[model samples]
Target chain A: MKVVYLDNNATTQVAPEVLEAILPYFHDFYGNPSSMHAFGGQIGAHIRTAREQVASLLGAHPDEIIFTSCGTESDNAAIRSALYADPEKRHIVTSRVEHPAVRALCAQLSGQGYRITELAVDKDGRLDMEQYEQSLTPDTVLASLMWANNETGVIFPVEKAAAIAREKGILFHTDAVQAAGKIPIDMGKNTIDMLSISGHKLHAPKGIAALYVRKGTKFSPVMVGGHQERGRRGGTENTPSIIGLGKACELARQNLSQENTQVKKLRDRLETALLNAIPKSRINGDTEHRLPNTTNISFEFVEGEGILLMLDLYGICASSGSACTSGSLQPSHVLRAMGVPFTMAHGSIRFSLSIYNTDEDVDMVIEKLPPIIERLRSMSPYWTGDK
Target chain B: MWEYTDKVREHFLNPRNVGEVENPDGVAEVGSIACGDALKLTFALDENQRIKDIKFKTFGCASAIASSSALTEMVKGMTLEEAQKVTNQDIAAYLGGLPQEKMHCSVMGKEALEKAIENCLGVTETSADETAGHIICECFGVTDQDIERAIQENRLSTVEEITNYTKAGGGCGSCREAIRGIIDKIQFEMTPQTAAKAKLSNIQKIKMIEETLEREIRPSLKLDGGDIELIDVDGNRVMVATRGTCATCKAADITLKHFVEKRLRDLVSPDLVVEEVTQ
Candidate 1:
């Protein structure tokens, strides 16, 4: 059975172009980029080209891009480095809807005497700017927020938020793992001091990501062993994955228009069809200001796992924000923070698409999903037809 | 996810008795939609008082639905007496077995079954809960007796296991310390876990209180130009009358709470609460 892959926010299938671009690094050019010999000298040029390629996608300089293991590592390095640069300011601010990468780190920092003010989101997952402005005090060192939420596709006003932090002489960073490929991100136009990017969220293989640090930002290193990436990062570079990531970013920059047009249409169509076919199903985020390739819908009166298991029978891939799906007793914290009802939150399903998806895949999903919802609702004891 | 058993998958895919009995002799609902899982159980009894028809409505994960479905099938021909004996383990065992974290789904099944049986027998006596012991976990509305029963039935060891099995410390987790203490006390018969703690009878409590005042408190009080006398020992509170300088101290309340209470709490059972009595 052909698998209809839609859980792209979780991870994406590696593009053929990216694979072909990095294939030579594994065999013929296996020499370390740091060595003095010609064999390594040739590899050094490739690394520089890859760095430039990655920087080009973000509209940043090659010097500003520091490759790390993945988005979580990039987020870790950026937040910790910002705190290190300003030792006196012990307050940090972020949003309630942050990915666990930033949320967990800020929580750990809070235990070490650093105060955290988590800004809340409105019902549609939009951040409140008034509360955000109030949270920025003289003691705040940095504000880490995500450009777009992973669960809901709602895009935050990061550029405006960055300018807010800038007025206070505080650092600003965004985990752009979900937004970098799916939307237009010009680092040259934004005041964000740092931004994190992941490889697998785009069409690159996992284990490679980059942190874009604005030139001349106060610097520190999260990993401190060897002199790699100009001592901003340490340990050996994952050479093949770096090459793959560079290629993936180049492709993402090229396909940004297509993603906005073609992929967005498919997502909208799927959302519309699901909503029309299945009653009490509604989208979870602000539809106008969201990523182009994502939709999270809740099918009320049916459990998420039951819906997912039934979807799996037809080789359809998706994800859920249900408590049972996550092995915890509560649904997604992002949904809860938005004050989504307990009835809707537990049945929320996220279907994140990618460039590889076709209209046929969308059609297949629209055809197969409504019946699954109907089936689960039929078995549900609480469900009545009126709702 | 969760590594669900093949039997669990089968039962969830083709659930049995997925509706309510029209005129059920017994009906009960357990859990709530807010906590993410709930079950509404209804059963009809034959003229022989055996369960002739049983059905369920559940809004939960696969394990919860599967467990409910399995519970109905197991009790179809059994009398109310036999069905009342059904444990959470029996529900899990009926469907091969559930993941350890998903064990609460089976627990919900058993609770709903027990309540339904109570409804059938007209037994409104919720003895464990109606007597209303202190609620340990307010997040899930778990009572002290609920935690104790879960531990006793499932042999739960850690606070995490208690959350997975009973959802006691799963939310907010402010009750973790209370749950941990309960687990320790229940794990050890006479509070052998702590030398300061013991299962003292009323006479032993009085003797220990006098001995504690004579040994640990009076000597320290005498050194400070003050003294303490044990007046009464009722439950955990040790009512005491301060003598000499302690009686006229400006910070007498602080002396009773911080100095006296702290010392007694550290030396005797940690559950002890100290108070000053009127002379």
Candidate 2:
């Protein structure tokens, strides 16, 4: 079956260029970057170049880019570093619709006596700027928000929010896991203190991510071992994946415009066609303010897992915010936080596109998805075919 | 993705019975749209009072639809009594076992069958009143009885398992303590003699008060054309309501303090007080 891969926000296909760039690092150049021998020490130069490449993508100094295992680690390091840097401040400000990486960590912090002000979102999954501004207090050590939501693809005004946090003298971090590669970001233009980027979200292999810390930010190390990553992070580097990530970042920078134009068109096409063809369906996020490559649509009455399984039969990949899909009896926290009606929230499907997606892929999804929805709705007890 | 067996995939892809039967003898609806799953089942009876035809309409996940489909196929030619014997485990086994988290789907099939049978027998109202225990999980509309039954049927040992089977603690989780209380009570009952020797927790005490009311006091009250309902158990104070003739009887307070309190103190704990609340 031809896989019409649309679930790019979850992960992306590793680019051939990235694979080629990392091949030699595995076998012939299998030497630690920290070794004293020249054969291994020369690998450090490549690592520097990789760091510079990643830094260039984020518009940060090469010294500010710290390579970590993945997005979760980057998020953890950034949030914990802020808290550890300011022990007197016991309050943290964040949004309710964050990815589990940040959301779960904040929850744990709350259990440990840190006051967390989880700002609520509007019905369209857009955060209220006034509520956000009010959430930042003098005692708030950090305000960690996501640049874009993984489930709904709603892009937050992180740069604007960061400026507000800056006025309050609070550290601001953004988990750009879903936003980094798809959108253009320049650290030089924003007051953001730190940002996290995952490689797998950008056609790079998994197990590689970068944390961009602004210069002169008070940092505390999460992993305390080797003096690697200038003591900001520990452990030996994932050499080949890091190199691959560098290549992927270069490709992402080159393809950024294509992502905004070509991928956005495919996403809009799929969204428009599906909504037109299917009744009792609506988009789940703020469409105008969302990522260019993603759309979340809810097919009411039918469950999301049923729709996903039917789509799987046709070799079309997507994801859902349904309770059954996540093994929790409630729909996704993101959807629930947005105040989406439970009827629609139960059947929310997210279709995230990438630069590799084509018009044919969009067309294939449009052709296969409506019938699947019709079939599920037909079987649904609540679907009376009235709407 | 869930590791659904080929059988589950088969039934989900091509569900056996997809719609309602015309002028069906038995019909039932379980779950709700807000709960993220619901099922409507209908059946027609044959000459032998067997289920001649059965159909289901489910708004849920793959496992839920497959379970409903598999259920109608399983109970086709069976009598209502035999069909009543069909457990959620049977439906799950029919699909080579559902994922533990998705076990509630099979439970929904079983509940729909039970309710449909009650609808056929014309005793749904009585059964509904009996099963209308206090709502423990407000998010899922799961009653205490529902959680207890799921625990007993599935041999569930933890609150997480109860959620898997009945969706009791799968939402805001405010009812987790209530679910834990139910589990403790059932576990205590499973090993009653052993639990009796140990110092009772507050939940165990509440369970004992309920058990004593149902077993010792209610039957005696019913013998006199009256009934009783356990209202609340707060510490040593047990609040109950005399129902039917007992509610208006002049000796209701005497019966509460003398018979009910005395029986509870003897059977459950030494320091027990029963107070009758007029409804």
Candidate 3:
């Protein structure tokens, strides 16, 4: 089967250059970055270079980047550090559309007596800045929001939101897992105190991620062990994966413009072709303010899982926000927060592209998806063709 | 991805009898768009009153479509009685067993079959709102009767199991306590206790009544600024005193009989009655 993978926001295919760069570290240079031996100490230099590479992509200082297990750990470390720094502040402000890493942690915090203010989004999955500003209080310890929603690809004004939080002397964090590689991020020009990036979301291997903590931010270590990651994160370095992430980040910087131009064109082409080919279909998020390489479309009167399965038969990979896909009776929380009708919410499919995606990939999905939607719609009791 | 059986995938990919029968004798729809799945079933009967041609149109996941497809194939050429005997389990068994979460798909199939049969038999041409059984899970529009039927038919023992089978408590979960009440009621009824069974000792009866009050009745009562304290348990008359707002509330007696007594009967024993001891 000629697999046409479009589920890049979920995870991306590791670039060949990244794979090749990391293989030598796994075999020849397989030494603990923390070891006393020269062979191992040499790996430390490479780790520093990797940190610089990641920092360069985000426009941040190398010393501020701390590698962790994955995006979830980075999000956890950032949120926990904010709370730990300001223990007196019992309230936290976050969006309702956050990924579970931040949302679940906020939920757990709410149970432990900390207040959580989950700001709502508009019908376009765009946050109401006035509501966000009103949500912050003197008691608010931090404000955590996502740079881009994983499901809908809607981008939030995290930089502007962070500035608002900063004015209130509140720490701000952004789960940039979905935003980092696909979009250009300049931490130096922003007020975001902490940002999270996952390796696998780009073209790096899994099990590696980075948390960017501003140089002067009051920080607390979530994982305390030996002086690894300058005691911010404590674990023997995932040397090979880190090296892979470095190469991935370097490549991401080079391909950033191509992502916005070529990948975005493919995504738009696919979205436009599908909407033209299929009736009763619409985009889920703000098309103008979304990730460059992502498009979430809803085919009414048909369930998403069925569309995805039929797509799978043609070796086309994608994802959905449907309840059946998530194993929950309710549809996607992001869509629900945006007040998307259940009729369309159950059938929303997210097609996230990447640098690797070509015109053929987009065309293949365009060619294959409309028929699948028509087939499923034919089976739907609600589908009356005209309506 | 769901570990859907190959049979389920097969049926879903190439669903049999996909469409409605023309001028069908029996036609019905189960589930709704809001609930993320719905099925419309139509069947024509042969002169001998057996199902000659049956077809389904479903709007749901792969498993749901497959279950509907599998159902039309299973019931074709069968008498209405035999088709009525087709359980959701049988549908799932035919598909080599669905994932536990997708069991509701098969249940939807069974409900569609039963309703279509009722339509054929002229029981109700309008297809009595499938959701007409006292809506328990408002999000999913699942009913208490729906939960009870799922529990009884699937031998479900937990609230999660009921959700899997009927999507009763799979939403906001505010109805979980109500679902637990239904589960307790059905399990107690199915316990095989008869009139000839061993009688409960006084101590055992008192302990059971107290347990029911604490476990079931009190929490719900407290939610409404009320509380119940077990005063005594003599024979089947369990005495309880309402504290807080419940003591002076206008609906105290109604609470005593409907809420308190019903819970006691459902959880401890069916014969038990609740009486409030006025201060």
Candidate 4:
């Protein structure tokens, strides 16, 4: 079967270059980075290079990059460290559309006595800047928001949001897991105190991620152990995965333009073709501001999970914000937050492409998806097609 | 991805009956676009009042569409009486089995079939109005009676299970407490008079105790930099120990008697007594 994978925002296939760069660490540099021996010490230099490589991608200081297990760990560490550092500031604010890494943690924090303000988004999945500004209270410790929505791929004004928090003397963090590789992010010019990136999203192996903490940001550690990550994150370093992540980041920096151009064109073609082919279908999220690789489309009356199953049979991989796909009865919280009608919300499908995807993949999807939607719609009780 | 059965996949890929019966003797629709899945069922009756043909138009997940497809095949040649005997379980069983969370899809198929039979008989057994029953779940528009029937039939014990069977507390979770209350009421009704005295399992008792303390007692205690922990639940007596400021508060005994005891009685069994276990 020819697999047509379009669920890149979930996780991605590890780039061959990244895998080649990482595999040798398992055999040659198996010595712990924290060991006193020269074998380990030599490994540390490579790690330093890896740090610099990741730093170069974000335009961050090498000293500021803290490698964690994944984006969830990075997000947890960022929010907890900020709150722990500023115990007096009991209020925390974030956008409602944040990935569960931030949203669930913040929700738990609210139960633990810290105030949480989840800022709402508009119909286009764009955050309200005015409300964001008002949300920064005197005791606001930090404001964490995502750079892009995983489901909708709607980009946020995170740089401006970070600046607003910076003006209020509040620590700002952005979970840039979905944003970092797709969009150009230069920390040197931005006011974001902390930014998170998951390695797998950018073609590195899973279970490796980095948090970019601005130089001299008041730091507190989520996990304290042996002197690693400059005592920011602990436990012996994930040597191979970290190296892989750094390689992925370097590749991401190099492919930034290609990602925006070739990948964007493929994504646009997929969306435009899908919309044209399917009736009563409309795109979710803001068309002008989405990530270059993603397009969320809703085929009304025909549920998403049904369409996904049909697509799966054809070896096409994608994801859905529909109720069934969410492992819960409700539709995607991001779509629900945007006030998307239930009719469309249950049928919303997210097609996120990657640099590896070609025109054939997009065209194949365009040809395959319409028949599936039509078949499901023909069976749909509410679908009269006359409307 | 859902672990769909091979039978479900087969039915979904090549549904047995995919079109409506022409000039059908009966027709019915259940669910709506807002509800995420729906089914429109139609059937024609022969001279002997036997179902000559049956077909369905369904909008939902694979299981939902497959269940509808399976239901049509199951009822095609059966009499209306035999068709009326079809349950949600029958539909799911015809397609091997559906995921427990997707049981509602089969349930929808059964309901649509029942409504189709009712349409033929000009009966008023099933009502789809919001006024017919008080809406407990505003998100799915599930009513109190709908929830009660689902509980009784499915033997659902948890709000999560109730949601899986009927999508009651599956939305914003605002109706979670209401759903829990209904589950509790249904369980109590089924409990024998003698069983009511010891209705809760050890797991259930511990869960109920922990939930009561966390929901009712923990917040006020935590606000005072204090906390309560359930040491053990031994029959009707709940052994608890306090931590933080709660351990040494001057009003500790009064707080235990007045606050903890009252809440435990209201939510859990009335006979539950909170006894503080000293460190």
DockQ by candidate, in order: 0.49, 0.63, 0.66, 0.60
Candidate 2 lDDT over A233-254, as tens digits, reads: 8899888999999999999999
Error of 2 at A181 (Å): 1.3
At residue B157, candidate 2 shows an lDDT of 60
Q: By DockQ, rank the candidates, best first.
A: 3, 2, 4, 1
The sequence of per-residue lDDT tens digits that candidate 1 reaches over residues A294-338 is 999998887898889888888999999988898778889999999
- Chain A TM-score for candidate 2 is 0.99
Per-model fnat list: 0.71, 0.95, 0.95, 0.86
Tens digits of per-residue lDDT for model 2, B211-266 = 76765567568868999998888888888877888888999888878878876776
Screening candidate 3 with a backbone cut-off below 3 angstroms (N, C-alpha, C), the clashing residue pairs are none
lDDT of each: 0.89, 0.91, 0.91, 0.88
* Candidate with better TM-score, 3 vs 4: 3
lDDT of 3 by residue, B1-279 (tens): 899989999999999999999999998898998899999999999999999999999999999999999999999999999999999999999999999899999999999999888887888653465545788898988878888889878867667778899998898999999999998788668555532233777887787778767766776778689998888777888878889999889998998898788766655677987787877
Better of 2 and 4 by TM-score: 2
Q: Candidate 4 residues A1-387, lDDT tens each?
A: 999999999989999999999999999888887778998878899999999999999999999999999999999999999998889889999988899999999999999999999999999999889999998999999999999999999999999999888888999999999998999999999999999999999999999999999998988888899778889988888999999999999999999999899999999888888888888999999988889999999888878898888898888899998888888887888999999998899999999999999888988898889988888888877777846
Off by over 4 Å in 1: B125-129, B190-279
**TM-score of chain A for each candidate?**
0.99, 0.99, 0.99, 0.99
Candidate 3 A-chain TM? 0.99
Clashes of 1: 0
Candidate 1 chain A minimal-lDDT segment of 10 residues? A378-387
Model 1, residue A181: distance off in Å is 0.8
Give the per-residue lDDT of model 1 (tens digit) for B117-160. 98887877576357657789988888888888888787665677
How many Å off is the CA of B119 in candidate 4? 2.0
